[model samples]
Target: MKYISKNIVFSVLVLSFFGISSLNAQNDNSKIEQLIEKKRNYNQTEVKSKGYIIQLYNGNETKAYAVQQKFDEMFPAYTSKMKVDLPDWKVQIINFKTRLAADRALNLFREEFVGANIPKS
Candidate 1:
């Protein structure tokens, strides 16, 4: 009878330990899920508007197109764009995501395009 009682007490203690550990695990999972949801909401509302561009030419439309064409031929890997800012038609290499990337491209461009520069923003 004493052995049976001792076995029962030990069984209860082991079961209670596992039960408490499981409850703590479930609580940890809930906290982790809440953190993930908050991160998702933050990402959804974030607006990314930082980057750099190198302007190759700023002149008339005819010269802008000519510069863009020449730039396209020289640096086929990079994408070029033209923008009309009032009196000047600007030819630019768009979407350099970092200053280092823009500077590297600018160095290469200066070898061929004398006017290649990153415009002040």
Candidate 2:
């Protein structure tokens, strides 16, 4: 009887330890998930600020035109003309309300241009 009680006590201790560890692990996971969601919301809000600019480029005029055409079709009335800071011949499209909006428009253009580059709008 003494030996049986000792064994049961040992088993209970081990189970208790594991249960406590599992609870801690679940709390940690919840905290991590909350932090991730907060970060995502913050990043999205930062990019969604209106009055942002975007720059896009391509070496070929036909390629540039193709990208522009795609943007026109996908995001009607979203594209606007802007000039690069320097006097380079490359034309810029701009006039987006938010960085996220610019990104959405640029992504649409990228599908067509393939190699064309776009800066944050």
Query: How well does each candidate superpose onto the true structure, as a TM-score?
Result: 0.59, 0.52
For model 2, how does the per-residue alpha-carbon lDDT over 2-114 read when each residue is reduced to its tens digit? 99999999999999999999999999999999999998899767754446554455345654555566655665766545343343334456666655676776676666545
In model 1, the Cα lDDT at residue 98 comes to 69
lDDT of model 2 at position 32: 100
Residue 76 C-alpha lDDT in model 1: 96
Q: What ranges in model 1 sit over 4 Å off?
A: 1-49
| Worst 10-residue lDDT window, candidate 1 | 42-51
Error of 2 at 103 (Å): 3.7
Candidate 2 — which pairs collide? 53-121, 54-121
In model 1, pairs of residues that clash are none
Candidate 1 TM-score over all chains jointly: 0.59
